[model samples]
Target: MLAQNVKKLIDDKAMDLNSQGDLADYVSKKITILNDYIEGKRELSEPNVDDILSEIVGFFTTSLDIPLEEGTKFLRARTYKVNHLEVNVPKLSYIPLDLSELATLGRLNKEKEPVYYGCIYFEEKGGVNVAFSESNAEVSDNVNILRSTAKCDVNVNYVGIYDYVHRQCKPRFMPQSMFEYFEAVSKYQEEKFSESVFLAHLLCDAFLSDILRRKKSGNLYRVTSILFSIYTESSDIDGIMYTSVKSEGDPVVALKTESVNSKLVHKSCDNYRIINDYGYAKYHAIHTHYGSISGNSVSWLKKNT
Candidate 1:
């Protein structure tokens, strides 16, 4: 009976989602200025850009259904220092960067906006390699730089940039029913929301554009940053999961600091080093450490070789 009931529930959800009511009509009505702007048919009026962005934010926040009840686990890496050869373990502060010290724009974060970033598995490589790749770590001959990465478990409810674009890798958290509904809505030519939804897709492409390269402050950062701020500000979305430009489409999640503080948990942190030779790179792990957080800092407790 339980198995039959589960099947019935799944079937009912499929049927209900298939019968989407007025979604295309509503989106078409909301994104008039943005649709015109993307089609190259007209120039945006003085305040039209702002209005269009508002519409985009509204559409994503309301139209997309994000399931964040289940927490997703990923690894976050940061440069680790051991007292220049003094300390023997890593601290809790090593888990994430201090937002108060933020000096530049990220692909999805404005300066001082606390977003905890993590990477998932990519091909044969695990989340650790993807995390280090996302770090843009450099290889130096004279200097030894160590990195510490932690496994972060949290409910990272996110918006994605993978569905409509060609990517080297697709994240596991990619939304299923919501995007298909948009695709169906985009095919409704009689309602003409097709063009509108398509324009919105172009905006999403910008979010993953090669121009907005990782770790560099591109000129378009302001625009993309605004889009991010607006999309995350009014919603319960804890993170924005997008493809990492430096990692060949590896998935990266940028979680809100508040969310990290409240929901993130990890059992251990691993220390490692990256060695670069000419054009090739190698990684070596040295130890794993455990610790706890206090007031605005962390203290390392123990370590294992």
Candidate 2:
């Protein structure tokens, strides 16, 4: 389905040949130096990091323009919840983080930059909900959490990362746009597409090596956050979609706070209280609520469940 989506994007817009030659020149020259550095043929020197990042940003900008559905749902889990007794009270639990709350670097946002991070439903393998994994929430007899779900109320363009997992990872998705970019470059330069593809994969592995690591160290997020900043520089993109590291490559999204506040509607939320055995986890729904947006506030209705 993803490959077909890319094909449809290609069909809808004719490839602009104007930048093809320049893109080809840049990749061909950079790939050789990158390979030399990997092979220890030359001592590691600081290659132009911004130039490489720019090429990546340029590739996505030129290649695809897939828009997400208006009804797409995003699931966000919280270790805490709103403590209120009223049935129709305003709540901030289902909204994006406040500016003061967003003081650290996240998977895609820089320090102090507000972003709405959520796990999306994966249709492959019947269905998979990655919210728990993405939130790093583990429930047992002693642990429980609240989950807030929101629906996209407007069509938004989110830039997607093609399959980036190791080949050993299961269920590799189709049509990696990185290789496609290099292949297009190869076409203009009359270079072997396979060779360019090999270099492209090597580049991905080199640059994104720390992307899937489980550690939440601040330094690890520096590169990805920079990439996202570059991608959104045009203002045409509202967010980014990438594989969730904690969920074994399940799709996840990070939308700018402005985009989320303007385009997403709070749908519902559930409080799961675990009451099972110590080694096992079972969710007991303590409460459920349906949310309605008003002006800048969200009012909730107690749902009997």
Candidate 3:
């Protein structure tokens, strides 16, 4: 279904020579990478999965131009009142530290569990990305089915497949571009699309539950799922985004950064892992930052992940 979705996205769009060629090139690159991972000719290692999830999430929110302030809620109520999903979240127990925080970080600590952040539904699996944000890529004329476009140039295969496969759901609340906002978010009943689409179901479940709970409780606020904290040298700004969490506890957390020539070597985005000593973290894949509590960061870290 996903591959077909990619193909149709190719077929329907009306593009000029340059844009069409660029899109074709982009889709081809993704397909080649996906094929290798699917066939095991090459695998998206534990870290790579993190990278892909980041990109996937990026496609939905940032690259698609969906702002971090905008939260993805379920179209409707959930059928399965599954609350222990955190316990069942997908895991990669030994992904090495560098891959855990990010594929680029290059730290390797295999002694601990590699963290994984995805879920499986209806036999399909999906995960959120660690670094999915508009800042990572510039976006324009983002197209997803719910929104309508008379003529525009931005395109990606994910948006194409969603437009066709999830055609039933009207495009609601699109980025500044003209898209119809669904009066109420749609809901999936108890049936599944395919194993590949199961993760969407899980997301639907989690998001709906969150939206409903917030509606009732009122103190709840949904943060962007892909959380990040970054500072660019030219900008001289410290920015942070929290994912689906309301962490009002810590007022000040240390930034363990190094000064490289006049630049800073700071941690971009890493999930806090178990701390070894002196507030330094010993993490495997997907673990980076940890908070010190009760006079010890180690004990607190162990209980969190």
Candidate 4:
């Protein structure tokens, strides 16, 4: 169910900004095109439609700015489960790490300004309830059941679970405000909404209501640098865990890095550049936002900060 909801949001963006009502219309068009391409009926890539898809992903990340405060807050509320997160999942909580070992990652790009979305370690879990995705070729990039691409078009990367949600779990159509108003109504009677219901409203606001609010109030934006904190731990769980407020604009996210130890922000487009203290290389990673991985970057950050 969660996967379906996410997919709807991603697919809807293929048609328009973030309206759930518009998702089917956009997806229908994408599927039709993909079918034509698969049957040798059309070209490989459509020109402009992909941009729309990227925009929709951005809207889901909670990074997109909606003008009205209610809309902004609503979008923030829905884009992710940042709630009860700190209480139940200690790992989900944002922690500041010492980049004194900054050379381990790379030379910080001291020039660029960074947008801050708190961090979480990216981890790879095993023996989980689900398995990973197959490949990007099996599904339409625009709908992105698996895989993603950036730069406004061309879906690339790991299979996205959100696309499943879009295809299977979209809400019945209604005006954005009206839909949420009903939520208020249910709560007004002191009704206890289920966890799923709460998440539904959060996601609904992120993809639908929030974008509408941005369109109306002039709060929409394009982003550049994205910041995330990578964490590491000792023992059996070996790898890295990276977390941040994930956004899905087709932008490449020219990376601007921040650290608790280093006061300055580093913005770098060169993913391969390495920084060494006393000519010794330690650790380095290519930067991306809302991305997933296994384990933490370098132990618990909470100890120092």
Candidate 1 least-lDDT 10 residues: 140-149
What TM-score would you give candidate 2 relative to the actual structure?
0.58
Q: Which ten residues in a row have the lowest lDDT in candidate 4?
A: 127-136
Give lDDT per model, in order.
0.46, 0.46, 0.22, 0.23
- Residue 241 displacement (Å), model 1: 1.0
The segments of candidate 3 whose C-alpha lies over 4 angstroms from its true place after superposition are 1-22, 43-62, 67-166, 170-305
* Native RMSD of candidate 4 (Å): 19.4
lDDT of 1 by residue, 1-305 (tens): 12344345434433443344544455545455444444555565525555656655554322232444434455666653332221322222223454355436665666766566666543423566666666655442111122222333343333444334333333444555545444443333113323434444444444334333444442345444555665566446666666666655456767666666566554344445445422222344333444343444344543554
Identify the runs in model 1 with alpha carbons over 4 angstroms from their true place. 1-52, 59-65, 68-71, 80-103, 121-125, 140-217, 277-305
If scored against the real structure, what TM-score would every candidate get?
0.58, 0.58, 0.22, 0.20
Against the true structure, candidate 1 reaches a TM-score of: 0.58
Per-structure clash totals for the candidates: 0, 0, 17, 45
lDDT of 2: 0.46
Q: Alpha-carbon error at 183 in model 1, in Å?
A: 5.3
